[model samples]
Every structure is written in C-alpha cells, then in structure tokens.
Target: MSPLARKRLGRVALNAAGVAVFLFAVFPVYWMVATAFKPNDQIFTTSFIPFPDPPSMDHVSRVFTQGVAGNSIWRYLLNSTIVALSAVVIGAVFALLAATAVARFRFRFRTSFLILLLIVQMVPAEALLIPLFTMVKRLGLYDQLLGLIVINVGLTLPFSVWMLRTFVAAVPKELEEASWIDGAGRFTTFWRVLFPLVAPGLVATSIFSFITTWNEFVFALTLIGDQGKYTMPVALQFFVGQRSTDWGGIMAASTLMTIPVLIFFLLVQRRMVSGLVAGAVKG
Candidate 1:
C-alpha cells in the first residue's frame, strides 16, 4: 500500500479500537441503569434487554420507601455522604499543607518522605485489616463513623499529598517570595495567595478522597456492624438472600448510591479544570 493509504488505515484502526473500548466501558453502565428499571421477574430472564418496553418505577420506589438489607437506601447514602465529605475535608487540609511543604522547602529526607508515602499506599488494605480491626477495637472506635474516617484519612492522605505536591511545585515560588517580602506572614501567603492558586489541586485531591471513602467496602464491613451505621457499599449487601439475590433491588440501590458522587463531581468539575489550567499557566 502507498504511505498515505497506510496512514489512513492506521487512523481508521485507531478510531475503531477507541470505539470498542468506549463501548466496553459504557455498556456496563448502560446495563446497570437498564437493569435498575427492570421488574424482578424480567431481571434474570431479560438481563440484556436493550430498554424496558414498559419501565416500572417499582424498584426505585421500593429502594426509597422500603429500603433493602434492613436500612433505607437513603440512610446508607446519608452515611456515605457524611463519611466521604468528612474524609475529603480532613484529607484536603493535610494534603494542601503537606504538598506545600514538599514543593517549597528542601530538607533532609524530603525524597524519603515522598517515597514513604508511596510505599504506605502500596501496602494492601486487606493485609492490614486484622491489625486495624484490633487497633480500632482496642481504642473503642470499632463500628463508629469516626473510626472509618480515621482509616480513610490514613489510606488517602499520602496519595493526595503527593498529587497536590506536584501541583504545588509546578507553581512559581517567586510569587510566594514576593508576598513574603511585602510583609505577609507564611500563613497569610499560603492562605490568601497560594490557596486560591492551588484550588484545582484541592478539588482534585478532595474528589479522590471522597470517592475512595464513599466506595470503600472491605474496611466499612470490617469496622461497622450496625445496619444504621453502614456505608452505601456495605449496605448494598442487604439485597442478597440465601435462596435468591434481589438483583433488581441491588441494581436500584447501586444506581441510587452513585447520585451524590455524580452531583459532587459536577459541582467541583469546573474548579478542577480551572485549577489544572491555572497550574499550567503559572508553571
């Protein structure tokens, strides 16, 4: 084939591959939503049905009214929101400060600290689950939202710090120095000038922390035993029975569980984009 024809063929192949991957990802979400609208009788038999010919709100209504696994879906959603938002807020404060320090100050073990953070993240949560369980139990924190928040913070903090550190270091230190020279305190410079500049870093890190905590299952299951205190991920387990799984209810619950996260991302998505652009421009 001619060189021009070969390039055209390659481009066509690439586009085809991209579409295939998109479909692979999107099909599952489409299937989930489709299944959520399905009636119980139709769910197992017609799992691949393209669209509900006569969609029923029965599953969603039950999810809202009757709940599943012993607690209302909304209650689990509320618990998830409280835990996730709290984790995000706490993690952001630490990440921002830690990122600033790692980016700005050169000190002994600076590289080691960054590496250590990565190492901690590498350790499997399952591996530490037993020890963590015992520790929480001993501290009288087991089954408490406070305990979950602490663990989530520890799990998410290191990665968020490293991510924010990159954004922080990308910023020009001269701007900070100028503020300092003009009689601004370190806190003032960071809060007044630097914080606004790094809003994207904060948004990105906060989203990471929120999603991590919100979707976390194993830890929530291990730590919290009470149905009233269950996060959405753990609470979704209630849809299963020994004889038969409540597939429709599970799908409905999972679908509802995603709403808060979707809303949160939509709200902060603009800031995240702006933060990236600001970082690139300032860098």
Candidate 2:
C-alpha cells in the first residue's frame, strides 16, 4: 500500500479499537438497564435480546411499592448518601490540611509519614477489616453511620493525602508569600490563594472517596447488624434468595443506585476543569 493508504488504515484500526473498548465498558451497563425493563418472559428467554420487547415498569414499581427486607428502598439510599457525603466532606477537609502540611511544613519524619500513607494504601482493605471492626466496636461507633464514615475516611484519607500532596507541591509557594507581604494572614492566604489552586485536586479526591464509600459492601455488612441500617449495597443483597435471584429487582435497584453517582460526577466534573483553568490564570 502507498504511505498515505497505510496511514489511513492505521487510523481506521485505531478508531475500531476505541469503539471496541467503549462497547466493552458500556455493554454491561446497557444490559443492566435493558434487563431492568424487560418482562419476566424476555428475561427468562435464552435468546439474546438487546432491547426490551415492551419496556415494562413492573420491577421498578414492585421495588418501590414492596421495598426490600421490610424496609423502604429509600432508607438504604439515604443511608448510603449520608455515609458517602459525610466521608467526603470530612475526608476532604483533613486530606487538604494534611496535604498542605506535608507539602509546606518540614516536620520530623515527614518523609516517613508520607511513606506510611503510601504503605496504608498498598495494603488491601480486607486485611484491616478485623482490626477496624474491633476498634469501632470499642469506640461504640459500630452499627452507626458515623462509624462507617470514619472507616471510609480512614481508608480513603491516605490516598487523598498522597494524591493532593502533588497538587500542593505543584503550587508555587511565592503566591502565599506575596499574599503574606500584602497583609494577608496565614489563614487568609491559605483560604484565598492556596485553596483555589488545590481545588481541582480536592474535587478529584472527594469524588474518589464518595464512590468508594458508596459502593462499599463488606464493611457495611459486617459492621451494621440492623437491616434498617443497611446501605444500598447491603440492601441489594435482599434481592437474592436461597434458590432464586430477583434479577429484575436487582437491576432496577442497581439502576437507582447508579443515578446519584452520575449526578455527583456531573456536578463536580465541571469544577475539576474550571478549577484547573482558574489555577492556571491565578498562577
């Protein structure tokens, strides 16, 4: 083939690969939504049906009306939201402070502290489950939403601190110094100058913490004994039975569970880009 033809062929190949990857990632979500609307007959059918024949709202209606485990589905959703939001807010505050400290202040064993954060992130969460559970129990935080928030904060804090540290370090210290010379106090400089520069990283960290806590199941299940206190993930288990699984109900619930995440992402996603632009102009 001529050189131009070869280049065209490679471009086509790259486009094909991109499409394939997109399909791979999105197909399950599509299937789940489709299945949620499918009639029981279509769902049970062995044939591949990409779309629901007649999109039925039976499963969704049933979930709303019947609920799960004798508790309203809204309760589970509320619990999840509460835990996730609380963790995000608390974690973001501490992570930004810690990141700022690590980047700006030189303390004894500061390097060691950063390393320890990385080490904590490296260890699997399951490995720390037992110890965390014990500590939560001793502190009388177990079975409460506060405990879940604290656990999630601890689990996600290391990553946030470690990630935000880079953002903090990337910011020029001269800005703060200039503010200080201009009669700005330490808090003023931090809030007015430093915080804006670091906002993108903070938003990113908050998104991570929210998604991690929102989807967490093992800790939610093990820590909370009351069915009424179940988060969305734990509540999802109610759709499964000893001999059969409620595929439709599960899909509907899952679809419902996915919306808040989409909304949250949509809400912050613009902030992520805008903050970067603002920081660039400010710098």
List lDDT for all candidates, in order: 0.85, 0.88
* Segments of candidate 1 deviating more than 4 angstroms: 1-14, 46-48, 260-283
Candidate 2: regions farther than 4 A off: 1-7, 262-283
Report lDDT (Cα) of residue 43, candidate 2: 90
Residue-wise C-alpha lDDT for candidate 2, range 1-283, written one tens digit per residue: 9999999999999999999999999999999999899989889878899899889999888888888998878889989999999999999999999999999999999999978987888899998889999998999988899999989998889888876787899899999999999999999999999999999778876886798899998899899988889999999989999998999999999999998788877777764454334346557
Candidate 2 vs. true structure, TM-score: 0.88
Q: Which tens-of-lDDT digit does each residue in 12-79 have in candidate 1? A: 99999999999998888777888889876678783457886689888899988999766778898888
In angstroms, how far off is 28's CA in candidate 2? 1.3
Q: Count the backbone clashes (under 3 Å) in each candidate.
A: 0, 0
Give the distance in Å from residue 137's predicted Cα in candidate 1 to where it truly belongs.
Answer: 0.6
lDDT of 2 at 107: 93
